[model samples]
Target chain A: MNIPADLKYTKKHEWARVEGDLVYVGITEYAQNSLGDIVFVELPSVGDIITSGEAFGVVESVKAASDIYSSLSGIVKEVNNELIDHPERINQNPYDSWMMAIEPSKASELEVLLDASAYEKLCLEEA
Target chain B: MKKTPLYQAHYDMGGKIIDFGGWALPVQYSGVLDEHNHVRNKAGLFDVSHMGEIMVRGTEASLYIQRLITNDISQIKDNQIVYTPMCYCDGGVVDDLLVYKFNDKKYLLVVNAANTEKDYLWMQENLKEEAEIQNISDEFAQIAIQGPKSETILQKLTRCQLEKLSFYSFQNNVNLDGIKALVSRTGYTGEDGFEIYVSPTEALELWRKLLEAGKKEEIVPAGLGARDILRFEAGLPLYGQEISQDISPLEARLGSFVKFDKGEFNGKEALLKQREQGVVRKLVGIEMIHRGIPRYNYRVQFNNKDIGFITTGNHSPALGKDIGLALIAREYAQIGNKIEVIIREKKSEAIIIQLPFLQKKYKK
Candidate 1:
């Protein structure tokens, strides 16, 4: 349950790292843990427009499949190609292995997500 | 949620708990794939205490069971086990279970955990006057030692000569680490293994002892998650998935387990008619040719029409690809038949293949 102080999280277990115009999006450790042994990742194509709290892709685990949601409204700028061959990388290093890079239409939308501490508390309550 | 006698041991070994059929049980320890591979190559022990055990006894025990199940119990010899389905009057399956014949006057039935209580009541109501049925699920614990190295590891702790035991056969009252146990050369996984039945009090000690004794073989404690994946790879039909109260065994492709030639069994007439006419739907194996993985309840399409739905699916740890079992129209179950699985409103191409997706190697 490593919640890096600099990152923001959503109730859906997605994390966003605010980096000026580009924000890195990936699932959190807690999300990957609950999903169990990720096998395949379907990433949104670059240039695809996504809305906050909407499903943009799917993560298939050995036990079940789950939808990955967009944390903020954005246009996908890049999708991680490494996940195509090695989806377990997301399980190994969820925070560092970003699923996609998006250029937000409104970067201020990130403020609606919870901070690291609040997100950690939410995760505890979920458990 | 019900906890088995070995619940604390599972938790202490880093098992991840989940609610399975109203029972609080471990779904995995390390990971599903890792545990699956361990059982395939090395050895793995499973706490199957949640499985139901029932005893049927009396002078008419054999007659009572023959009228209660779809399979012929008369063919079962002493110390032998038969895999079959218990069906409702309407030809739908109640549950699939293993019947072990102890003698002419007594028989043992191992049923699915989720259907234990229901099955017991069903049997009690339908039982004839001469026979009595008892539920003994709580009185015992079952441990399955599965994989290629299982025999050698288990041989070190048991007095019985495991080499003489044939597949689907059992020996009673054998000493396992000074405790009497019933060891059966049968398992759900597609591997050579033994299933041991012991008193609940000896379960934790037996598990610990086996884990320690099996160190060289790298035997691990597997959970339900791994068990599901392994059985799927073997093409074994699960209760709720492949067959259920609303689904008949004929449609589940388990017709071999139903002996129609044996006269006057439960649901015999319905099955006989079904056999002559054939079922409209049948369970089949699907291999994903596209990127998306198919999951349970996903729609199956053929010839631009919805034909069926997926019963179970996952990336097989052994095969390393997306595979699934689905119930489809009998016309679409042919090998190399092309079909589509609907995933999140999009269609993914799939092909019907012969099961099992992986080959099995049961102990002789």
Candidate 2:
């Protein structure tokens, strides 16, 4: 699993890149690999709000559908409309394919997110 | 979880194992969509050893089968197979299985893996003095080579005149290189293929050998995930979803398989009454008009009223669209009827289309 050291991740397999008060979020490589051949990705609207640890959308594969959770509480600033037509892009390159951009409501919550090392350890333990 | 005889082979192939109805089995190998397309264009081998097998023998075997299943087993000759549904007294499906007749006094039943014990017990309860039933699942293993290229690929393994074997027919003890096995021209995938049954001991060897023999044909090892999608696109009935304890053959749109003219059988009285009165619900196909995909057990609405629920839904790799099977009120079961599928609390647009999603390429 490729966990970019520069970004932050969550135990739920979501990753966030912090830039000022704006955070670009997407499912991690581990999440995309676990979900093979992603057929559809349902994402929240551009201005929708999502609380930390709450399910904001779904990512469906050939086998089953799974909920994608938000890492930090925020109002969505941008939604990756590209995923609606080409969800397989996430499987091809998860880290680069950000799903949403959020304006953090609780900016301090980003600190609570797991670092790459911690997230990798959590994935190993779960596996 | 229970393990099939070929479990180790699946592990070695880097299969993604999942607990399927208490059995530890591979849900995918390369991937579901990849394997699915492989089976459609080339060929794919599947380890179906987890499926249950039961032997029925004695002079009353033929007589007993007439009362046990909805299809007429007598229509099939020796070395032939018949697909049928076993039902409860209330006309609900107990299970759907393939019955292979070796002779008038002997038969083999291939049932769903999870329903083995329950089906065996049900058989015993209905068994007669001369008829006997035995759960021989652990004693045997099964594998299928399915796709358009399956016949040519499998022909290289066995000297049997496979070209002479018609669909739904089997030959017992055909030597595949050296392994003594029963090869049948039957499969779940809508493709011209063969299902091979052999002793559990030879399972892994046979699996490896078949994969090796079909290497040139691009036959990949498929798992439950791809198999499910293949069968779904073929318009086959799944036990729990399409038909179950509360769903009858009629409601499931498998009424043609129920042979009321063949004489009394399990669920005959109730089914006959149901036939006379007409089914209140009917199973139909749905194609999404909205962006979202519908899923299993999702609510279906007609005129904003909860009319039914989706049995199974998936993105058809072939058709490149979202399709599903739904059992709903008969009044709303007509083709071209528009409906709403509740996907994550939001209503999505869908329309009833002709079943099967696409033309089946079975015989070719």
Candidate that scores best on lDDT: 2
Measured with DockQ on alpha carbons, how good is candidate 2?
A: 0.88
What residue pairs are clashing in model 2? none
lDDT of 1: 0.90
Question: Residue B39 CA error for candidate 2 (Å)?
Answer: 0.7
Q: What local lDDT does model 1 show for residue A7?
A: 92
Worst window of 10 by summed lDDT in candidate 1 chain B = B260-269
Whole-model lDDT values for every prediction: 0.90, 0.91
What candidate 1 gets wrong by more than 4 Å, as runs, is none
Q: Evaluated with TM-score, which candidate comes out highest?
A: 2
**Candidate 2 lDDT over residue span B1-364, tens digit each:** 9888999999999999999999899999998999999999999999888889999999989989889999999888999999999999999988999999999999999999989999999999998749888898988899999999998988888899898999999999999989999999999888889999999999899999989999999999999999888888888989999999999999998888999999889999999999999998999999999987778899999889999999999999989999999999999999999999999888999999998876777662
